[model samples]
Target: MAIQKQEFIERMKRLQASVRLSELEAFLVTAQDSIFYLTGVTYSPLERPFFILVRPDTGVVLLAPTLDRDHLASAPNVDEVRAYWDYPSPPGLGWSDGLLELVAGIRLLGVEPSLTQEIAQVISAWQPQAVPLIERLRLVKSADEVAMLRQAASYADLGMQKIIQAAYYGVSEIEIFSQGRAVQIQIIKETEFDPLNTSVLTAAWPARLGTQPHGVPSIADRLKDGPHIGLSFLRANGYAAECERTFFVTSPSQNMSEMFTLMLEARNRAFALIRPGVPCAEIDRAANGFLRQEGLGDYLLHRTGHGFGLGNHEGPWVAEGSPDVLEENMLISVEPGLYIPGLGGFRHSDTVLVTSDGYESLTRYPTEIEALTLLARRSMTRLRGALVRKAVGVA
Candidate 1:
């Protein structure tokens, strides 16, 4: 379900309250996600700038390009809508002019840390305070946001199922990736989902290529008798979730099995630490310490995980050196990995929600090695994948 209009209004109220407490005359929100959080409005500003000005007593005003004036009419909780001709216009009619006029009498202005330097220079005279008021508010998911994330997680699970079903001995990475995409397209066509806010992406990092944790999938890299990683990341409506797994077309060697076991254990350790009020860094430390003690520290790559919502990767980072603490309703991913050059990567990721007492795994695909191992034989999805690859001219 989409976030209700009332929720958006409540968010604006909270932001305005924060602005007043900070002693700022006005708060300018430039981040796209922050604007969406405040007013249920989505836009791809690209080079054109968009602003949401929140005043203590004046309510909310949106400064948008003239092209979007009509489109934004349906936006809820906005007290006023002002427009500029475009990005670069006559000195009196551009975005800068509109912005300056909006805050002309304000002595103190608060801006999001995401504001671009050029825009910052434009209002340098105000010496805008870079406050993370909106970001901090976003850290804890509302009941509505959690519902959207659950929907997104279900789609991610479906995509992962398609990916695993399509995998076979000679299947190329792109072929497997295409099968997941086809399912996503079909879902959008048949459901009430907003295509602009929904996306599903899959990748297969086969064999040695999996060592490059962030490597792009290649058509030439086919599944083999070794560890392979599959990733299914999607956002339904405005919320995001991810599901990833490490699988093998054939039985993994004993050593590879051992590595997978360690990786899973590390993830479990992190999961056991999730609860309201726990320091985010402690979760990472417990997981990292486990791997380091197992003599696999050299193979460790990135952080244990990170929070996700409107943006795929956001605040309340679940990593060493992070200052944020876990709070109820915060959604985070738990992924601890070990990447060995020739042996491939061993990692599994799931979107998890921090609950009052513990956590809930939203993307509940089979994580055990037995369930992940794909039989190297023909299947309907494999045949469909082959047809898709041929249609796309991928030999």
Candidate 2:
């Protein structure tokens, strides 16, 4: 389920209080995610600018494009919604006119750091301060947000399971990803989930391509007898979670097996350090330090993990040089990877919630090497995938 209206009301109230504390006559929120958090409203502004003006005493006002008026009718906690005719309207009917009218007498204004340069210049008269008030507030998840994240993580786990089952000899990566997406679609239909707010992305990086952590997948590429990275990154009901695993279609070489073990150990080390009041960097150091001691530090590519919420990747980054401290109710991923050039990549990611004591993993997919290694099974999926690829002329 999506967050209740009461939660959104409380969020707006908190933002107002923060604006008052900052001694700003008004604060402008330009980011879509921040707007959604303050008021239970979601819409893509495209080229049109959208703004939420939070005043210390005047309450919350939404300045949006006319196209979004009816769509945002049910949004809670918004005192007023003023609409502009369109993006490139005439002098008196444009977004700038409406914004200027709203903040005519405001002497002190604070705007979200995400405000575009165009908007910054338009509001330069106010000398707007770029404050991350809403971003900081989103670092910690509320009980409802945690529940949605847990539900999203469960879907991710299911997507991983489907990907593993669909991985067969000669089956293409797209075929395996398709099977995972099919299952998620079925769930969305069955539960009547909000289609716009939910998303499912399954990907496979096989053999050499796995070495490039962000490499794009090819439809022609087939899974082979080596280490493969399977990813299930999804969001359900406005909350996001990720589940990833490294699996082998057939038995792996000795070196591959050892590397997988080491990668898992690195992830566990990070997991052990997850608790309230812990520095995010410390968790990363624990895992990276262990890998460095084992002489595989050069293979470490990215941070241990990152936060998750309304957006796929948010604050409280688990990496060196991060200034964030772990707090209770923060949702984060614990993924430590080793990307060896010829051997392929070894990494596993799970969405975990930081609790008062330690942490709780929401994605409960099996991670054991034995569980990950799959035997070639005869299936029609291979034949079907090849025929579709040929028919579509996708080489």
Candidate 3:
């Protein structure tokens, strides 16, 4: 079943209670996810421009060009839908004027920084003291929010299963993307789940020597054979489960194989450490420790993972200097990768939900060395050419 309107209203009530504003008086949410979260509305109306205006105590308002008004009207929680003609744009105070008028008398106003510059300027002109309220409210996920994320992970698992079965030699990278995309669409149609847009497929090589983090190849190029390649995908809701595994087009060299194994161990160790009260920084260090022991420490890249929810990337990033404590209901990724120049890259990533005592992995693709080797064998020579280009001596 779809999220209830009453749930949304209750969320607003909580937001209202926190701010001590009987209602926000007015909150103009420009971030698409924020709009969806607050109003339970989901649609891409603004081909070029669109915005959501909410009066926490009063009602909801939608502003868009005439072309999209009909579609925007269907969004949940929208009470007064205002449409502005496109071709013959309204006079002096056209669409903006209507938006301005919608909240003309409101004293307190809130806005998301991601909102268009023009809209922010308008909101500033009307209420110079608008509060930065959106992020604070969105930073934490509720129970309904957790359920949505879990459902997205469920779909992602299904999509990955379909892609794994089809991942083979001679299939173009585009073909893999197509396969993953089709599976997601099919899942959406069959499960009646929310629409998803996320990293559905990937094939990336580590930088040179397979030892230096700085070694790199431009992803703009198409998929090729040789060095190690990694693939990660997600069947997204507003939230998603992101899982990744490396595959070799041919037998991985001894070093390449070892690197993959180490990365997997790091990820598993990190996963085991996940529980309420664990420090986020400690988790990053734990994974980084594995790379250090292997003498590939410098080549390690990015954070262990990050919070996944309404938006693909969220807060509580798993990295050094993080002050976040692992909390129940939090969903994140534990991906530790090793990238070296001249050699390809190795990474094993999975989405996980923190629990009271332990953690639950959302993306459970085969991470074992033998299983990965078989997948690489199935991929065949597509990886060789790519690896040869990265390393001068590879045959």
Candidate 1 residues lying further than 4 Å off, grouped into runs, are 186-191
Model 3 per-residue lDDT at 84: 69
TM-score of each: 0.96, 0.96, 0.79
C-alpha RMSD (angstroms) for model 3: 5.6
lDDT of prediction 2 = 0.86
Tens digit of lDDT per residue, candidate 1, span 161-208?
A: 888888888788778767666667766765567666677788778876
What is residue 204's positional error in candidate 3, in angstroms? 5.9
lDDT of 1 at 99: 90
Residue-pair clashes per candidate, as listed? 0, 0, 22
Q: In candidate 3, what residue range of length 10 has the lowest lDDT sum?
A: 205-214
**Given candidate 2, what's the lDDT at residue 12?**
84
lDDT of each structure?
Answer: 0.87, 0.86, 0.64
Number of the top-ranking candidate, with TM-score as the measure: 1
Candidates, ranked, TM-score: 1, 2, 3
